[model samples]
Structure formats: structure tokens, C-alpha cells
Target chain A: MVPLSWYLALSAVLFTLGAVGVFLKRNIISMLLCLELMLNAANLAFIAFSSFFGQVEGQLFVFLVMTVAAAEAGVGLAIVIAVFRNRETLDVDESNLLKL
Target chain B: MTFEQILFILFAGIVVGGAASVLLQRNPLYSAFSLITTFVGLACLYVTLKAQFLGVVQIVVYAGAIMMLFVFVIMLLNIRDEDTAVDPNRFLVYLTIPLGAILLGALLYVVTKVNLAQPTGDEGGTVERIGTNLLTKYLLPFEATSVLILMAVVGALHLAKREKE
Candidate 1:
């Protein structure tokens, strides 16, 4: 056994990195990429727990998550492109039309 | 070290390195590329953890469909012509590095503290069982997801199509 804690610890690291990357990167697309990383981290934890407990529900949840991720990626990219169309910029700092 | 441990280390390196490059790269397109690497590592990890179905889905849906969507959007936006804008808060970006390390340390502490029951090995993850579970126990959510994808496709087309002024 590779130890369950190792996988959990790795998940935590990836999640934190994604969170920090969301703050560090100014581009909306980069932040979206970071979000995907975070999502993957969560998925990793789910899979780890499933394997540790020898259950099937976690894999099912992974299926739903992947479904949602696919939907989210499609819709999010569309929104990004829409915003770019209106504002002509991809940078988060530059696209602050709603800022008062 | 066991073979599983060695494989875990290899996948971990790929995941971490790919994630670092995703944020460090200048172009969003390159970030998309790095995202593919991360997904590949994640899928391998899933396989090692014995979630073979999810491992395949991670590769097929994430690395395949999601990345292609990202690349399509990157090309569609024509983001290359614009001069690369610098990150506004250089200090905070640097500060986040150590902060993230500390967070990882804290997480390691928490992980070590928890003791889960060892596997009983009664049920293993088989594709047929997953499919049965998807159809019976998770039927509602599975069907709902298909509907969600339908909505997403329609919404994406509506959102991205050039509106006639």
C-alpha cells in the first residue's frame, strides 16, 4: 500500500497551489486553468477515499464531476470570449468594467 | 520503495511541475498545454488508486475534451497579438509562494492526524458495477447531467455567436 495520507497530502498541495495561482495570475484564462487544477485535486481526494474504503460511489461522483467540469469548461470559455468581445481584453485587471 | 510508491512519485512530479508551469507560462495557450500535463498525471494517479473507470474519464473528458475546448477558445480569441500584460501585484505573487508552502505543511499535519479504517476488500471498482450504480442508484443525477450538458451546449452557442447589431 502506498499509504492513503500521501494522496490526501498531495491533494492539499495541489489545491493550495491552485488557490495561490488564482490570486497570482491576472489573466482570466489562467485563473480558469487554476480552477481546473483545484477541481482535479478534489477529484483526487475522492478517488483516494473510494479506493481506501473499497467503495463505488466515489467513482460515480467522479463521473458527475467530470460531467460538470466539461459543462463548466465549455460555458466558462464562452463567457470569457463574450467578455473579450465586449471589452477587448483577457486580463482580469483590465476587464473591470463592473468596478465602481 | 514499492513499484506503486515509485509510480506515485513520478505522477506527483508531473502534476506539480505541470501546475507550476500553468501559472508561470506567459501565454494562456501554454497554460492550456500545461493543464493537459496535469490531467495526464491526475489520470495516472487515479489508475494507481484503482479507480480505473474514473482514470479513463479523467483522460477522455478532461485531457481530451476540456483541453480541446480551451485551445479552441484561445485560438478563437486571437490572444497572441496583444502584448503580454504583466501581473499587477508582483510582491503579492512572490508572497503567495511561501504562504502556499505553509498551507501545504498544515495540510500534511492534518493528513497525518487522521486514521481511516483499512480496506475490507469486499467490493472493488469494476466498470460493470459502476454502470449499474449509475443506472440504478445514481440514475437521477446521471440523467440530470446529460440535461446539464445539453443546456451548456446551447448556452455556449448562444453566448459565443456574434450578435447581429
Candidate 2:
């Protein structure tokens, strides 16, 4: 039998990797991808809990989360594209126009 | 360990490995591909968790829709591997490593602390139940999300328009 703890541990590791990517990577798109990774990691945990606890609420929450993630990615990529058009580079360091 | 357990382990490895590759890769396009693999692995994980509807949704929405958008943008930008700027801040790297370690430590601590007893209740997480709950109990949030998506679409149009103008 696969233990729930194993799933939880895997989720935790994935989340940590995402956090590292978010913090270490300077590219806006890369950071956004990492953010998606983190969200999926959380979704894994939610589904695992739902299965372990035999409740549908956790799964329901995962559905809501997926919707929100899609919305977020749409808006975020739009912003990234806009920024890239003006700056010609996706590197965060070069596009500090708002740094007053 | 049984077949399901082995499959679970294989999927977990794929998910983690793909995510790590996304993080470590220099090319944005390569990272996008890795991310797609990660999504596929995640969908499989959802299946192992008994969320059949969610698993399909994960593949359809994330792997199919969202990943295609990412690939489209990456291709549209025509970002080359050599285009990336090199950062010389070794100190930032040092700082992030320890900070990430601390965060992971805290996460593990919390996970170990929780006593997750097996849940006993109705298998209420099916598509029908979710749809019913969304229309009835969580109707407001459901409507709110629709509004949010509408706003995002409008915002994206606005942003795209400014570039042409």
C-alpha cells in the first residue's frame, strides 16, 4: 500500500523546489512557471488529503485552485509580454523602470 | 509494494525531476517542455489520489490549454538560450539557498506534526457532487471566478492592444 505520507513528502519537496526557483531565477516567465509548479504541488497535497480523509471538499478545493491558477497565468503572461515588448528582455534586472 | 505503489513512485519521480529541470534549465523553451511533463505527472498523481475528474481536468486545462499558451508565448518571443543575462550576485544565491532550506525545514516540521487520521464519509467529491455544490453552496465564489476570468480577458486585450498602438 502506498502511504499518504509519501505523497505529502513528495509534494513538500516539489513545493520547495518551486520556492527555490521563484527566488533564484531572474526571468519573469521562469518565475511564473515555478509559481505554477508550487500551485500544482499544493494541489497534489489537497488531493492526497481528500483521498486519505475520504472527503470531497479537498478535491473541490483543488478544482477551484486550478481555475484560479489558469486566470492568474493568463493575466501574468499578458503582463510579461507587455514588459518584454517595451524592454526587449525578460530579465528582471534590466526592466526596473518602476525603481524610483 | 504493489503495482499501484510502483506507478505512484514512478510518477512522483517524473514530477519532481521535471520540476527540477524546469528550474535548472537555461532555455525558456526547454523549461516550458519540462513544465508540461510536470503537469502530466501531476495529473497522474491526481489519478492515484482517486480524483478522476480532477485528473482529466488537470490534463485538459493545464497540460493542453495552459502549456500551449506558454509554448506559444515562448515561440512568439523567439527567446534564444544565449539571450539570457548572467547575474553576478553570488551573495543572493547564498542567501536563497539557506532561506529555502529553512522554509523546507518548517514545512517538514509541520507535516510531521499533523496527525492525519483516515477520513470516513460520503464519497462526495465526484463531478456531480462538485457541480451541485458549486451551483448551490459555493455559488457566489463560482460566479466570482467567472467575473474574474472576464476581467482577465479584458485586461489581456488591453495589454495586447497597447503594443499595436
Candidate 3:
């Protein structure tokens, strides 16, 4: 059987990769994709702990997290659509009217 | 050495590789496709964790529904590969290298220290057990999530609605 630490290490690696992607990616949609990556990494950790502790709470939390992710995706994509409609671009740096 | 370990490595490799592709892909459509692979790999990982219900839900909700929405938006926007914008805060990209290394190291240190005794056999993960818990102990939060979903639907409808001329 694989040790719990290995699962956790993978989760850590994934989360770091997502964080770095968020920092480096210029596209708003890619940033959103990275956000989903981070969420999945967290869900992986929760499930690993749930199985390790033999508790359902962590699984339940993951359920809630999934629910939230669904909601976030809906609203986030809507915002993306609206932004693209107005700005005619999906680039985060190009939509810097607020900085002006 | 074991089947489960091999499966873990395979799925983990797919997940990590897909996620990296998602970040590296210049086209949002390609990134969305890569994200689907990542989600599917995570679903397999969930099943291996014995959370069969979540594994199914991860596929249905994330890979099926959410990713479809992503691909739909990417197509609707007609985002091409060359549309990728220049990074104004280019220095932040370099800064993330050190910060992410520190973050990963800290998380690994903390998790490696968890040496709890192996869990004795518990009730195997089942829809019945999860459903019962959802209705009994977690009913309120479950209900709240419905409201949250409703709000999201309404908000998306409003936000994406065509503005009156």
C-alpha cells in the first residue's frame, strides 16, 4: 500500500504548480484554470485525510468544496464572457482600465 | 511494487502532466482540454481513495459539466493562440519560483510528520453512508448549497444576458 505521505506530497506539488501558474499566466481563463487546479489539489488532500482517519467529514467537506467550485465556475465564466464582450480581449494585463 | 501504487503513479503522472499542459498551452481551448484530463485523473484518484460517489461526482460535475462550459466559452470567444497577452508584472513570475518552493517544502514537512496508526477497517465508503450523513448531520449545509447554486444560476443568467440597446 502506498503511504499517506506520498499522496500528500503529490498534493503539495500540484498546489505549488497551480500557484505558480496563477502568477505566471496572463490569460484570465488560464488563471481560472489554475484556480481549478488548486481546488483539485486541496480536494486530493481532503480525501487522503478522510481515508487515513476513516472519517466521512473530510469527504463531506470535499463535497461542499465541489459545490462551491461549481458555483464559482458558473459565475466566473459569466464574468469572463462579459469581460470579453466589453474589452474584446481575454488578457488580464490588457484589461487594466482600473489601474488608469 | 503493488497494483495500487502503480495506479497511483499513473494517475498522478496524468494529473501533474495535464495540469502543466493547461498552464503551458497558449490557446484557452487547449488549456480547457488539458484541464479535462486533469479532472479525469483526479476522479480516478478519488475512486482509489474508496470514495466512489465523489469519484463519480468529480467526473459528472467537473469533467462533464464545468469543462464543457469552459470549452463552450473558449469557442464562443474565439480565442486564438496568438491572443495571449504580455505580462506587465513579469517580475512576479520570477518571484513565484522561490515562494512556491518554500510553500511546497513546508507542506511536505508538515504532512510527512503525520505518523498516525493505520486506520482500522471502517465502514467502507458507500452512497448510503454518505447520504445518511448528508441528510442527518449535514442537512443544513447541503440545503445551503442548493441556495448557493440557485444564486449562481441567477447571477450567471443576469451577467450573461444581452444588454438592451
Candidate 4:
């Protein structure tokens, strides 16, 4: 069996990669995809700790996380479309207009 | 290494590799493809962890519904390969390297030191227990999620629908 530590390590790496993507990618969709990656990493940790400690609540939280993630994805994509409609570009740097 | 360990490592590799592709790929469509693969790998990991429900949900909701929505929006916008825009800040680019190192260092430190008692078994992951817990203990949150999802649907329609001048 794989140790919990290994799973934790993978989650950490995945999370970091997502963070890096968010930092580097200018496309809003890619950033959102990276955001989903980070959420999945969190879900991985939730399940890992849940199994490590033997509890159902963690799994339940995973369920809630999924629900919320779905909600987030829908709204995020809608926002992206709306932004594209107005800005004609998906670049974050280009979209910045309220800089004060 | 045992079979489970091997499977875990393989799936983990797929996850990491796909995640990297999602980040490094220049095209948004390619990144979307990589994200789908990453989702599949994550779902498998969840199943291996005995969270079967989460695994299924990951497939159905994430890999299926969410991905389709993303692809549709991408098509709707007609985002071509040339539309890809990467950040221009050199400092931010360099900053990621050290950020990665720091996060990795912290992760290793914590993962090595944290200890856990052996689990009793698959008591928590069973569908029966999960269902009961959802209905009895987690009922409120479950209900709230449904409402939240409904709101999301309405909001998405309001935002994405053509606005009248």
C-alpha cells in the first residue's frame, strides 16, 4: 500500500503547479483550469486525511467541495464569456482597465 | 513495491505530467485536453483512496459536464491558437521557481513529520455510510448545495445570454 505521505507529496506538487500556472498564464481559461487543478489537489488531501483517520465527514466534505466546484466552474466560464464579449481579449494584462 | 503502490505512482505521474502540460501548453485547447486527462487521473486516485463516490462525481461532473462547458465557451468565443497570451513580467516568471522550491520544502517538512494512526478499514468510504451521513448528518449542506447549484444555473444564463442594448 502507498503511504499517506506520498499522496500528500503529490497533492502538494499538483497544487504548486496550479499556482504557477495561475501566475504565468495570461489566458483566463487556462488560469481557471489551473484553479480546478488546485481544487482537485485539495480534494485529494481531504480524501487522504479522511482515509488516514477513518472518518466519513471528510468524504462528505469532498462531496460538498465537488458541488461547489461545479458551481464555480459554471459561473467562472460565464464570467469569462462575458468578459470576452466586452474586452475582445482574454489576456489578464490587457483586461485591466480600473488600475488606479 | 506492491501493486497498489505501483498504481498510485503511475496515476500520480499521470496527474503531475498532465498538470504540467496544462500549464506549459501554448494553446488553450491543448490545455483543456490536458486538464481532462488530469481530471481522469485525479478521479482514479480518489477511487484508489476508497472514495468511490468522489471518484464517480469527479468523472461525471468534472470530466464530463464542466469540461464540456469549458469547451463550449472556448468554441463560442472562437479562441484560436494565436489568441494565447502569456504573462510578460519577467520577475513573476522568475518568482515561480523559488515559490515552487519553498512550497516543496514546506510540503516535505510537513509530510515527513505528520503521523497518523492506522485506519480501522473502509468504514468511511462505503456508499451506505456515505448516504446515511448525507441524509442524517450532512443534510443541511446537501440541501444548500442544491440551492447553490440552482443559483449557478440562473447566474450563468443571466451572464452568458445576449444583453440587449
Q: Top model by DockQ, which number?
A: 4
Candidate 2 clashes between residue pairs 3 or more apart in a chain or in different chains: A53-B119
Off by over 4 Å in 1: B80-85, B88-95, B117-123
Instruction: Give the per-residue lDDT digits (tens) of candidate 2, residues B1-165.
Output: 799889988999899899999988988778889999998998888877778889999999998998888888878885755445336564677788788889888888777765665555546357887788778988888888889889989988788666444
- Show model 4 residue runs off by greater than 4 Å: B80-82, B88-90
DockQ category of candidate 3:
medium
* TM-score of the B chain in each candidate versus the native B chain: 0.85, 0.89, 0.91, 0.89
Tens digit of lDDT per residue, candidate 3, span B50-110?
A: 8899999999999998889888887888675655654655888778889988998999999
**For residues A1-100, could you state the per-residue lDDT of candidate 1 as single tens digits?**
6888989988998999898888787778888889999999999998888888888898889889888988999999999999989888887777766799
Supply the global lDDT for candidate 2.
Answer: 0.84
Interface RMSD values, listed in order for every candidate: 1.7, 1.9, 1.4, 1.4
Which has the greatest lDDT? 3
Separate DockQ for every predicted complex: 0.71, 0.64, 0.73, 0.77
How would you encode candidate 1's per-residue C-alpha lDDT over B1-165 as one tens digit per residue? 998899999999999999888878878899899989999999899888878778888888899989998888888876743434555656877888789888888888998886676476545567898999999988999999999999999999999889998
Candidate 1 positional error at B163, Å: 1.2
Give lDDT tens digits, candidate 4, residues B77-164.
8675545756465578888889888987888788877667647645558788899999998899999999999999999899989888
